[model samples]
Target chain A: MKFSTEDLIEGIRSGNKRLIAKAITLVESKKAEHRQQAEELLKEIMPFTGKSIRVGVTGVPGAGKSTFIENFGRLAIANGKKVAVLAIDPSSAINKGSILGDKTRMEELAREENAFIRPSPSSGFLGGVANTTFETMMICEAAGYDYILIETVGVGQSEVLVADITDIFLFLKIIGGGDELQGIKRGIMEMVDIIFINKVEESNLQKAKTTKLELKRALDFIPAKEKGWKVPVLLGSALYNEGLSDVYSTIDEFISLKKKTGSFEGVRVQQAEKRFEYWVQEYILSMMKKNNSVEEAYIQHKKNASAMVFNPSTEAKLFVEKFLSKGPD
Target chain B: MKFSTEDLIEGIRSGNKRLIAKAITLVESKKAEHRQQAEELLKEIMPFTGKSIRVGVTGVPGAGKSTFIENFGRLAIANGKKVAVLAIDPSSAINKGSILGDKTRMEELAREENAFIRPSPSSGFLGGVANTTFETMMICEAAGYDYILIETVGVGQSEVLVADITDIFLFLKIIGGGDELQGIKRGIMEMVDIIFINKVEESNLQKAKTTKLELKRALDFIPAKEKGWKVPVLLGSALYNEGLSDVYSTIDEFISLKKKTGSFEGVRVQQAEKRFEYWVQEYILSMMKKNNSVEEAYIQHKKNASAMVFNPSTEAKLFVEKFLSKGPD
Candidate 1:
């Protein structure tokens, strides 16, 4: 309930799992006191945050996301790496509990000594991931985890935001599914760095191969974000643990290549800038709620217009002008 | 360009395509004079709009979006309805032209007497549809079109925005291709009112059917927005015009059902509210750019606190405060 900044920082720095988990819970809490504590914790851990590779994995409800992450995490650990799996389960608004029954679905990998699995319920965010997922990843990284795997619900806009925060975005797919070639929303696919054809075992093996070929053809029509980094379509079987090693190797190659070319740092800087922007937007929204001026004006505007009269633009301009005239923070 | 708002309104009411197009161009233009003219035009034509059914069509690139619209528009015309197709072409930053060659692709539909096709470039808006697309739809509605079809580049955030503005959202797909179910973004699927398994001709017929079944199964798992209104998965050959009537009937059914429940009016009101909000946001952004004090402060904020710069939320709050302090407009 009461944690000094130094205590949290030292606990996280020493890789104290219980303390780290507690800190994450504190950060994720909505209580007023918790927010202040979380902010202090973040500031203290800021210096050690950017060292790890944060990878985001997202797929549809039955897309074998958990199975794939468990396999992938195991593969990374086997390759002598410290991996942390942050599984974001979709939460029910009414109950405020995870829709997915339990985190035990990924028990095998969770039991591994080198792998850490934490399932966080996605509470009230449109994007499949939680608002604090980014901060959680940073905390995980500061605790000396080299690989932070963010597992998203893959059901909403949250995955894209999660992708934005992660170093690599893996979009998982099931082979021979009807949605194939049905033109996945370009927004999500465009953000994807790696496309994994999951459930590539037994009867689906050939279909997975065929799907990969089709995906490759489709990728040609899709413009690449950066040159030389075409989104590779890889085959994997989370159930059988097939091709998991190859996936890990490919990730390593990507990270190393990005580091060699300075893109690793470049991406981090961009992400930091984006985070700053997000914070500002969030802080302003909070400020608006606190001041209630926007709401008041909105009410007045509605009365005068005799229609639905919440004009965000005009109201925004007024808010900015008043805030600026007050001069410096 | 210098015509009076009355002339523009009269011309549009009289079904003058040139005048309607010119009015929309004026609305889209950044010029201050054009904006003033556009405002006047909107005021005059406001009553005439809201009669037309605005439908948004989106799919991945090479999903034959232009061809589908061309076919769909002809179908609407065959039903004795005046159709307006607003096609947003994917713009290349270098060439500044749409990659899909919109005008040429929909040449046949454009030539039809009952149909009007206007190909607009994306112009770098986040949502696949352009900023002016909403206003363009209004302009088209005012011009006496019974059905307005907004065709987005389908691959990005634009599709979602376009869907928000339209009454019904049509998601097109190519059979036996791409990532199938796993590849398509779940958010888009959930938002879609009708999922058309497009290009269902020749060798792909069986595949399309299977895909439809798979989609039907997938739909069962996700929560439906409209109670009892199943998100129909229909197979159609946009190239050969097979099952075109079915698509029209489905749309008609949806509209009739909504009307019966008074949801049609509710939806229109919501759309208008959305448009107002969008315009307000745009207006505020413009005002922020024009205001010297806010501009200076924004710059100083960026410079002084590079890492913690004010985001849109903060800026919006400030803008609102400023507008309120300055007294009523």
Candidate 2:
């Protein structure tokens, strides 16, 4: 289970899947020594990280996410692109194997030599899961994956974070109960660069067409993510191997357009800035957690706040004052 | 202009409008001494706070939000309730005097003996505006206002923060461009306790009715804020002086139902807890801003990140390590 730093760096750069997985697991480790090693490994692999086409996939459960990714990954491989699929389920910790935890979830994709599939980290905290996912993504990129599909279920804040780290965001929708965009949050809609209406079988083709029109109309009101680029809502069935090529071509078109406009590179830098901001918050929170007096003050303040002894803002101000006066470790 | 703490407290408690305004201005001041005075004033007025029906109102531009608030406040006064209307336009700092800045926007309500209207504080940051709004709300409560309406233009993060500080969140939507929920964000829809489709004139009555039904169906998919509460979408014309009483009665019913279920008090405490969390972040951010080494490191890391020298997470980790080792002020 233990590997030298140079081994991880070499294995990652040489596209060794086993060592890549190990590096990801190592970064996910909470051990202080492992964290130091992980940081060093990441720095060594920095040159290889930004070459992949990063795509984010999100949809409600039963929306055929696994199937779509499998078909899409296969299509990319057919087009001579190495694919890596990573899932980020913030609920994975509590739900305990509800989502991509099982390799069988993406069985076909998992069996592909050119494809890499990893489950959610089960970190319990969104930030922890996100950090590991980012690390895992960089490791995959170093391992020569030309395409990365970062998948997250449609729930809570995970999708938003996934969108932040990806070059393009894809949303999958299933027509059910006649309520189009029911589970989709408006913010997610705004973030989406492409949408796929999955499972458009012969029986539901009409319904799919209707939903697509409605979705397009709804999208017209929402601003496009980039100038001169329209978010296309494509209909396809991953199960039937239908419209997969269209989906693949659309993604390629989006990337080409973004690159042509020069917004593509700008976005990546901004994403890095956002990631840095998240780390700043994470570090501050970690420091607060380590301080005993801060912990005591937080507890006392919460109790007094419940009893309305003082305003919560006042208690917070007092807590911060005490914390700053104590100095950092 | 300069009064003792006792004078301010007595003025707030005795419902002296001038003194209440002065106390709020003091809290809005960024001066260190003024902050200390504001803390003292807030703590002294703690007992008198949390007695009013705290309501938050939000709508897109031209959603007739001011007209609705004016009518709603008048209705509350007709029911023998003292009303306070405060606007929280986060954009006010940049778009000087765009919304609720001029007293004439709610001229009728402003002239009411029992109604007090305050324009949005043109503090640039959303947090600064929200903090000042919270303080002003508490001051209004101490001034014996039985009903407080916090108005924020539906933009950015202001609506979410406003929802956190208030007991009930009401969303005002205007039927426009044939898009029922064109500008309304989904997260806002979820947080909304009640929705009013404003501008239902005779010509647009049918359109409003259709929009209301469509909105009701949309709300069905989103879970209610409270366990037993169904978020109602009501149709009303704020300009025509119609359905204002219905809106008032619905709000009263909601409060009573929540009170009977005992969730009302619990929500207020949770809101206080949320406000405390915000203050914690604000203080940490302020501390980071005050630290010079942290600033220098951030700039350097940003440059390196843009040049693709290292992963952003790695840079952020280095920055955090440096910041903590520097020790706090």
Candidate 3:
């Protein structure tokens, strides 16, 4: 099952599922040889990427995120589009796996021939987890997936990270009874492009309507995340497959609007630049780890700082001056 | 007005207000010679710093932040403690100045001999602004200020930055007519060590009670920010000076709890470490800017990246390798 670099490129280009998954594994690997091959494969597949609509979905737990994605994926396939689903859980290591790791959680979407699902890469720092997810998205795109769905638990900073990598950010929430809207996370309200109120049915229809209006009022206090786009909140029952078409149409209208305004391309470009910056920061930190002089200086300064013998800022300045003059090995 | 370094140190140690202000101006300056002198002053003052209780206060506009600080400062001064108030507004440039710049904002407190007020520094990036504020706090501490109050607009990322440098983070909010708790910014709730429901008088007392109960329920969903502390929500009217004593006592209790648990010193050490890291990052970025090969390669890679000829991550790796091996000059 060990594919050569050329094999990965060819297999991925031909939409070979196994090879696509293998390529993702390669990219996620920390091994130096695997990383070299992964980089090579990523370069070869670059042109084939950026062909899909990347959507990020986030919500509190028990909000029916998996059901919504399953239904959404199926709907996309019904329209003759291939779909790929990926999860990003920074806490995935302790949680065993993300919601997507258990295929049965998304059984309907998992059985679809045009669908692909990958769990959160249960390891690494926040940036690394996000990088792997981004790489996985690219691999899915090269495999001809027309839609990419990225999921994140709305509890942490991952929501911001996911919003950075995707074109559309969809927030899903469910109101238990009353006054739960205040529980919506802080900065997330400003980042959401569209919102889905899941689990709306006969019993909670009135409650959902009230929640929607309340949410609109709350949204009024915040500025639009994007120009020429008013964030829309739609109610639905994902478990019953209710209101799936509305969700699809809303996404359609949003994508077409963003594309027409040229912000679609603009966002992708910004995302690329941000991605580049992150990689540069990672590279610099890694290099610092390997440089003995930098490490020694850092430890010495830290000790001095803790003992109150030197100001942290002054210590940092002195360390940097020494580091640059001697060069990092 | 031009005091030598030794004279400035003596003046500060003796608690001369003019010298303290001059020292702050020196640290805030970007001139090379001034920076060297500032560093020296900071190292010499190290033994005198870390004596004050640092408190950060943030609230939405018109939430009576200035009035609250005025009343709170008066309370501290009445208790035989000197207090210094500083503001941090990232949007200060366009907004003319932070709420504190006018002096009239806290006229009563400004007139008190025990109180010193400094407006937000009207320049630099976010980190630079925070660094200046931290240095100013140290200078105030060395001058025997018993309390340092840092104020942020509670709108931007400044709340997080302010939280990083202070020992206690207090969030002041007022509930309007109905359901205004939803207006609370997301992540701020998690960082708050104490919450003050400001403007709680006869008319809004009922409304404030509802908001308090609702906020407490919402807080239930979030884990404790610190191990031994339970975040408290208090009610008070800053303008009427009705609940100033309660706010002061709450802060006193929280600080004592933190000190008893040893987390007070632990937090300061962590803050020191974070400050050092930020300075290092700033130094590296500045070095990269001055390095010609790094800039040339950056532009070339940027061009290739925009043209879709090179993946940004790979480009970043290549650039770092070249920069480190050749040394940044």
Ranking of all candidate structures by their TM-score, best first? 2, 3, 1
Top-lDDT structure, candidate number:
3
lDDT of candidate 1 over A101-189, digit per residue (tens): 47567788878877776766447422112377777877888898989988776555667677667888888888655747553543565
TM-score, chain B, each candidate: 0.87, 0.90, 0.91
DockQ of each: 0.08, 0.42, 0.33
Better model by lDDT: candidate 1 vs candidate 3? 3
Chain B TM-score of model 3, please? 0.91
Compared with the true structure, model 2 gives a TM-score of: 0.89
Q: Give me the candidate number with maximum TM-score.
A: 2
Candidates' C-alpha lDDT: 0.68, 0.81, 0.81
User: Interface RMSD in Å per candidate, to 1 decimal?
Assistant: 8.7, 3.7, 4.3
Q: For residue B91, what is the lDDT in candidate 2?
A: 67
For residue A318, model 1's alpha carbon misses the true position, in angstroms, by 11
